[model samples]
Target: MKRALALVLSGLVMACAFGQGNPARGVRRPPKLQLFHEVNLSTFWHQAIIRQLAFSPDSQYVAVKLDPVLGTTELVIVEVLTGKKISTLRSPEYLGMSQNDRVQWLDNQVVFLGSYYRWNALSGERLADAPVVGWQAIFNQDRTQLATVENVLGTPSYLHVYDTKTWSDKKIYADGLSIGTIAWTSDDHLVMSVGVTRKSMGKTIAGHQIGRGPDVGPDVALLLFDPQSQQFIKSLWFPARARKTAKGIEWDISADLMLGISCFGSNSVTLSVNKILDGRTFDIKQFYSDQQVKSNSVAMVGGQACSADGRFLFIKDVDSWDGRHKASNSIIDLALSRQVASFPGGKEEIASSENGQFLAFGGKKGISIFLLNGE
Candidate 1:
């Protein structure tokens, strides 16, 4: 018996030293995230920075949010294949393209899902009839519908819903309440953060700013909305004090829970796991920070995005930030609940193409596009 026990002990030590018992030790790391494209903002143009990015339906083009020039806010379009500046939608200060802004393409024209009117992507014209341009635009589970407020200044308050096939909408009362973050729940419901209103504030026209503010959370809370019927649902509240980051909130959802990354600053973020049924908060304030990456890494909230098919969520985290920033994106497989891979991550904004073939990231400096190893 003593001899046998000694042998077992030896085996255990060997296993510990060689990582024989751990499931993750021998697993292969994901392929390095390839650079699909890059926009260098270091030329004579000093004031311009990439605020956000959107890929066209066919993924042939990408829209850079706001200015290629500082004082002017234009919808800059770039061809994905050739990296050429194809066009600009002139200056429309309201077209922020931030996480809060939901503008999308429809009928070959730029329209938020809620089509009160449409903006032309090529012409740079804000046309009158959304009779196709449109979300300041948020999409539901299938991207079939979009939830947006009226874009035309002083237009009657309405929560617009575009069902892809037709328009389904209802007028709203609190349309002027600033929107911090907007997300979709598993039941196909809308979840968002309501912030202070601007009806009488500094800015004159203020309604199209939903999803652009900070998380109105000392505690994680949500103002639920039912789009099919166009009704505001009950507010759900939680106990976790929302950590302050910069701006924007990114969500990954399941049947009973939601994974929300609330951006506090460039360095601080919280991966708040919430109970779907009752709005309970499970704080992972140090989730990525305490992660086993180099220890000094930080995640950028704008870089947190899920694939359109909902299979994976990619988050950009920095490994180093001295002068030349070293960053990589962490791809989490939602169904399996594991970090399956890591890609490049330093870009300020990230968006996945409709077919998921390309991942795009944008920043003040410029934009970088990448592809998964196999693709």
Candidate 2:
């Protein structure tokens, strides 16, 4: 019995001594993240960053979001084979003024999913027809039936949907709460975040700008919306005491539709990748931590795109100083690990692949493609 106990103790010591290397060691010395391809897109878009990027259904063409400061926003489509600009779709007034122009490739044609009207971002020419009020855009698996949002003025502001094929629109609303943003699940079910307008006030303690002007809103809670049943079945609340206030939460349904990532915060952030199965949502995964990433690294929001295979995610990290925010991107593979890889010149907008190929958004130099390998 003594010899057996001694042998077990010796094995335990050997295991501890030979334990795997530090698991918490972050991306200090991230491996290669090699260069796959780089293209010199046009130099017109400066201070201009890529917002949303998508590959065509056939995976031959690439569509990128172009935000040229003080200029209109354009969606530039390039042929992946030739690295040549094939087509450009611009956003119309009220839509292109800011950098929220979202250009998505559904099938053969690219559609602006955010608002209805489309315009020439460079020439300032109106592309689409009149304004599509309360209309939200969502694409099908084959990129058909662009889902749209339509605002219905009532107790609970309703959202209507329009089919891209027939141009027919329909209203979808629940009981309470204002409909903020809408998205489609993997199974083609609709989901949304519903919340009330909550206001908060803070007095000027010293001589600082103490939370009053454009930075105050009600405790924006999160709600899950179902378009089929037309109801908000679940609710999640944001932290009301943050210093910066709430900007609402963004949702990304995983490829399996069993998980999602919700971005919620004002100053300090909680970027949580959650799991939802069997009608229950659980916060199973997380990416960046406020204390670790936010404090030391540059933080920028707006463009977040996952890979086609749903194994990787891209986040637009930016730096803001004088009311202007400049951005770059990075890719994080949730499958291999919750580790991130950086591109040269500090990195901004990112788009990745399941096979480890990725595109990093470069301001004037165009887009850079690389493999997301650590070594």
Candidate 3:
């Protein structure tokens, strides 16, 4: 019996030494993080309202949208290493509607939403002028196709598919459901959030209406659709209390994994990361939840993006309603299920490169980039 007990103790020590036992759990250290670059918005445009930050495919340059006070919206390209402005491209038609411009990088070209804008990287010249009316616009993996959610009033919401080469579009899905956000999973598959809003008379209290007329239901659904075949593939429903409020839902799609942030009820929010290997099976994991965040506040993931390699997820926390409050943005190592690093300040948007080497964050103050190392 003493020999057997000695053998068991020896085996337990061996497991811990090999890093294969419960003793090593929760003791793993986080990855090392370092700040690489920071670009001041005021240096490029005075009092510029920065809208979007997109890194080039090669991580050499970054595209920035600057809404100036006197002129039209400008798309500026800057060298990542030196923080020097390379070229500034302007669109006269985008003067009044600068807020709606969503810039996306497609190889050497930058395509945006307003006026169906497409611009060249080297020359800063407009390539196409096909106007598409939508809020969330996403391009496919090849940049040849574009998908957008058209939510016009008094009509059923539709998914509009466009061909970038011919500047032609078609309304593929015209269901009664209103789409909050749309993203491309691949060249053939797309994912979107669908919800419905209903109106009812509010109770009169002290000769005043107590509640708003429109009572939005909390039955939101995330669906996967095949854009090539124009067919519905699969869907996953949200919790009954998880409805989209003023700050609409946001999601990041990287290969087979999707991370979604859903804000529901008056003060409840949840972040769900789903792995959809096949169109039919969806493996979902709720990573975070906040029960105290107000409804009017922006969702925690309003400015979130995933690394292209699907190894890391970055999120900018909404610490306070006022922009002055300092918040900690986190870099999560998905495989380890732990936060690797956190940055101080309220970063409005976070983006990473295809190779996961460079990360960029944008905010009211300015934009910053970091080089991820020691993974």
Residue-level lDDT of model 2, residues 311-337, one tens digit each, is: 555565666665454544455555444
All-Cα superposition RMSD per candidate: 14.3, 14.3, 13.1
Model 1 accuracy (lDDT, Cα): 0.50
User: lDDT values of the candidates?
Assistant: 0.50, 0.46, 0.56
Rank by lDDT, descending?
A: 3, 1, 2
* Candidate with maximal TM-score: 3
Better of 1 and 3 by lDDT: 3
* Residue-level lDDT tens digits of model 3 in 133-197: 66566666667877777776434587888887775887875345566655565335666655543
Which candidate has the highest lDDT of all?
A: 3
Clashes in predicted model 1: 25
User: Per-residue error at 88 for model 3, in Å?
Assistant: 1.1
Ten-residue segment with the worst summed lDDT in candidate 2? Answer: 261-270
- The number of clashing residue pairs in each candidate reads 25, 22, 0
TM-score of each: 0.58, 0.61, 0.68
Ranked by TM-score, top first? 3, 2, 1
